[model samples]
Target: MAEISREYMEQVAQMWNARGKGLITHMALEIENVSSEGVRVRMPFNPDFCVDKDQTLLHGGILTALLDSVFGLANFVTIKGISSMATLDLRVDYLRAARSRADVIVNAHCFRKTRHIAFNAGNIWFDGHEDAEIARGTASFALTRGDTSLLEAMTKGKAS
Candidate 1:
């Protein structure tokens, strides 16, 4: 992995938070760690994401969405000159039932990159149980490269 600056990581966090309204904002994700190698994020458990009346079991769809979002952040941190990116393909597996009120922790990284694409893999687990992964995912993204980076475009309010 290439070296990423602390300033750049801070900018990424700010950009993520400043996006204002969207699924990401609704997730209320926190950037626990960021590097050229990958990113780690925490999503607090929300009862609204539960499928049952008891609110113990999280909907699988929410877990999938979390992986997709974190994969994007992984790409953003690892790839350069990316003006935008779109998920070309995504595959997620539920290893175990997500039945806890604990915050979810996800670790994702861009494992490979080309001129126009990136591949990422990640896994998720509850806050304290690293031995038991609840979900795992792999995805590929179509990269749009340009002189203006995604970060710059977003910060300048020019990203769409």
Candidate 2:
């Protein structure tokens, strides 16, 4: 299989960032890396997403969404064309609390891909601590070809 070019992958990352709005935009999510093998993303700490009144801990849902997005990005990069995909299942294990003011780093790998399903695993950690992880997750996505619903929205017009 042909690999995606670095320039093209960078474009993909920018497109993904542009298409991200609402909660993702509000959370300041950024794509740090994209490749056929995996993807990396960073989400800066936001007091609005804090779970505690003191803003010392982040809510678990934020990490789950970030993991799902990163895993899905890994699957998308492997596809040759623009296709529609949905998360079929996601399992996340929380190992520790995410401290406030620290960016959340998520790295995901596409371990396996079949005709219709893509399997991925990911790890989430606070910046500056590679050995210490805040959470880890696995996800499966159902991919569809020739589905331009997203392609059209992303390329031609706004996505609903």
Of the candidates shown, which would achieve the greatest TM-score relative to the real structure? 1
**For candidate 1, which ten residues in a row score worst on lDDT?**
12-21
- What's model 2's lDDT at 103? 88
Q: Which pairs of residues collide in candidate 1?
A: none
Best-fitting candidate, scored by lDDT: 1
Q: Distance (Å) between predicted and true CA of 38, model 2?
A: 1.2
lDDT of 2 by residue, 1-160 (tens): 6767877766766776777668767868788887766788888888888888899798899889888888877776666554678999999999987875788899999898877888999999988898999999998988776656454567676642
Q: 19-82, model 1: which lDDT tens digit per residue? A: 7368888899998988877899999999999999999999999999999999998888777688
Give the TM-score (vs. native) of candidate 2: 0.90
Q: What TM-score, computed on C-alpha atoms, does each candidate reach?
A: 0.94, 0.90
